[model samples]
Target: MAAPTPIDQITDKVERLLLRHEELQRTNALLVEQVHALQAERDSLKSRLMAARARIDALLERLPGASADERKERT
Candidate 1:
């Protein structure tokens, strides 16, 4: 059996570290993409909510004002 040299061990360690760094970089990019996708979905939902609110307001405006007789009829 032969013992490994110090230089060879250092080289192996450096290679492993570089591989880990690359993996982390790829993971970060994926996370960033996911964040952007979620933000776009949030904006779309907000727009839809605003549009629905406007439609409801318009419908209310078109109807005649409520009267005491209409309120009494409900009961």
Candidate 2:
């Protein structure tokens, strides 16, 4: 087999680098998509938590006397 010329070596190296760059680009895109999904999930959870807290507050307000003493006695 003939030894590869310098140009051949450079071309091969360039092809490998291009392939690596393309792979990294794909991985970065996937990570970004995952982050977007996670952010949406976090927002949903925050909204749910806020709604539950509001409901609890409303329930507390409806409680008779709305006092720690009444809560302790009920417990």
User: Largest lDDT belongs to which candidate?
Assistant: 2
Tens digits of lDDT, candidate 2, 6-72? 9999999999999999999999999999999999999999999999978876787688755876755
Tens digits of lDDT, candidate 1, 6-67: 99899999999999999999999999999999999999999999999788766655668866
Top TM-score: which candidate number? Answer: 2
Once fitted onto the true fold, the runs of candidate 2 whose alpha carbons sit more than 4 angstroms away are 67-75
Per-model lDDT: 0.85, 0.89
Q: For residue 45, what is the lDDT in candidate 1?
A: 100
